[model samples]
Target: MTGNLTTIGFDADDTLWHNERFFRVTQDRFAELLQDHTPVELDRTALDHKLLAAEKRNLGRYGYGVKGFTLSMVETAIEVTDQQVPASVIQELIVAGQMMLSYPIELLPHAQKAVEQLAASHRVVLVTKGDLLDQERKLAQSGLGDLFDAVEIVSEKTPETYHEIFTRHGEGPERAMMVGNSMRSDVVPLITAGGWGTYVPHGLVWEVEYAEAPKDSPRYNAIEDLGQLPALITRIEDGL
Candidate 1:
């Protein structure tokens, strides 16, 4: 809502461009890469869950981005294969990460229009968490770089991070709003920090990023897509 929102922060990955799709595709490839080692009857769903577990365990060490995810996939391969995983498989996993890092940046439906429209009324900033170099590359390739008042590639999206971002870029949390796909990283923390939190759930969610929605919170709202953002902001400004 624009009532007290002078700055609106957006999450860059799945929330803006096609991100999680690449990861999902790569994960499928990962499953196939390790399929030979596991029993034929080993459930694919269980394997996927194991990979997710590895990723979550390594989040602190590798942080969030393709590199961290790639490492986790490699670790999972080794674990699933009982430390006998082949050199070629690890090589392929590295190649998969390379492919993801270089993958084309395809903006989500109405991402550009929504960003441009919102920028007209509010200070729109890109507040995404990930590997700095890869995130910078995506932003540059997205061609929507100039649309943002600022671009912040953060290590994590905690209350302290959001607070610092708002304080440095504009007013504090009361004058800010965060729009993203992650309930844990994007919405909950900002809302906890006294800012508006708008959840825009994507079809393919990273399991590690999932958290129960704070639906009962008055400051939180979940929208279907970015296309709805402009009108939502307008409604808030209109006090409707």
Candidate 2:
């Protein structure tokens, strides 16, 4: 029962490198800025809720990345401050976003080894969703760019997206596998598109990417990290 996989897709952000922690840090800065504008002591949980709402509302218009998240923060700040969020606060948020865009790319442990090993025997593709320019910048810095046979930086990840990408890059979804940190974006959708969805959890995940695991799906799998990816692929290939 050898695996039918012809192409293996990898998620960029938190899957291959550090991503969410920077967002968390900027979010903390956002909270502090908002607190200074209000007289009452801020409730961090409440503020987080408002920010998440803003992000969700703006997703369609702004899509994902530091630019969208920055805009959402500004929108949330204005709403939370009763439309009186100061200019300085907004400026700082903008600076924060720039800093995030410029942050150094730190490859996650075993990321290079995992991708390199898989690429030797499989058509490796990078299928990630984000602002195109920023994703490209990260890839250029990662030094793993040459390892991928192809790269797809999309606005969103869905079943259709996976079908299109895998088909274009390899055989098709049925003969491909997608590995990433998000259950919603990286795993479930690929499984729905008839590919194996392999979940690799990151330390911090964006709330919006949360989704229930497809425990009943035979194509679904999970690994502790990229370090374990090669072994898992072997097991899957062996039909174990």
Candidate 3:
């Protein structure tokens, strides 16, 4: 089974197109708006903690998207300030969240070439999670749409998603590998499902799910970017 792979799943957002930079910009704006109520030292951290807590709490009812983020920010603000935070601040977050305009919408530096090479030798699947319409529009605009054998825009990534994905593509767990930027969204679940995964680091990952996983963990490997994907895959399979 070594060095022989039939299928690969990729994550979209920060892994393919530019995603978190928009959120960073909006967050900067958000901090500026709330400066009057929260202290200078508490400006960013307080708001961030509040929002993350709120989002996780409401994750089930709302799901992850601009609307959830916006509502979370508003509720977080009110929670911290103990007053109705200005509607104007929430509106700014809302505008930033539209997300149609959030991403730069260009494929990462070598995403096209890496995908091209992998597809020539193995099956390629784009498994991204986000607001469905915006995610689809991004792929359509990316011009890399036809390259993938299957494109999965999921609400969440769990062992079940991986099982369904591999079964649908007729690819076995041992024969498939998932690639992406987020550990929680991509690597953790795949490993849990007895599948392999390669993590390509992004400049800005979402804050909530950021952490370091032990290198000794099987089914986990890292690459600098998609440019190194082809070799990286072989390197991981070699059990390096």
Give the winner by TM-score: 2
The clash tally of candidate 1 reads: 0
List of clashing residue pairs for candidate 1: none
Candidate 3 per-residue lDDT, tens place, 117-233, comes to 888878899998767777777898898999999999888889789978976884666678889898887887777787887888897877666656636776778889999898977
Model 2: colliding residue pairs: none
Query: Candidate 2 lDDT, tens digit per residue, 1-240?
Result: 236788999999999999999999999999887887865755889899989999999999999999999999989888889989889999999999999999999999999999999999999999988788999999999999999999999999999999999999999999999999999999999999999999999979899999999999999999898999989888878879
Alpha-carbon runs more than 4 Å astray in model 1: 1-3
Clashes of each: 0, 0, 0
* Candidate 3: stretches off by over 4 Å: 1-3, 37-42, 99-103, 235-240
lDDT by candidate, in order shown: 0.90, 0.92, 0.78
lDDT at 71 for candidate 2?
Answer: 95
Top lDDT hit: 2
Candidate closer to the true structure by lDDT (higher is better), 1 or 2: 2
Task: Give the higher-TM-score candidate: 2 or 3.
Answer: 2
TM match of model 3 to true structure: 0.88
lDDT score, residue 52, model 1?
Answer: 87
Model 2, residue 162: displacement in angstroms?
0.5
Q: Is candidate 1 or candidate 3 better by lDDT?
A: 1
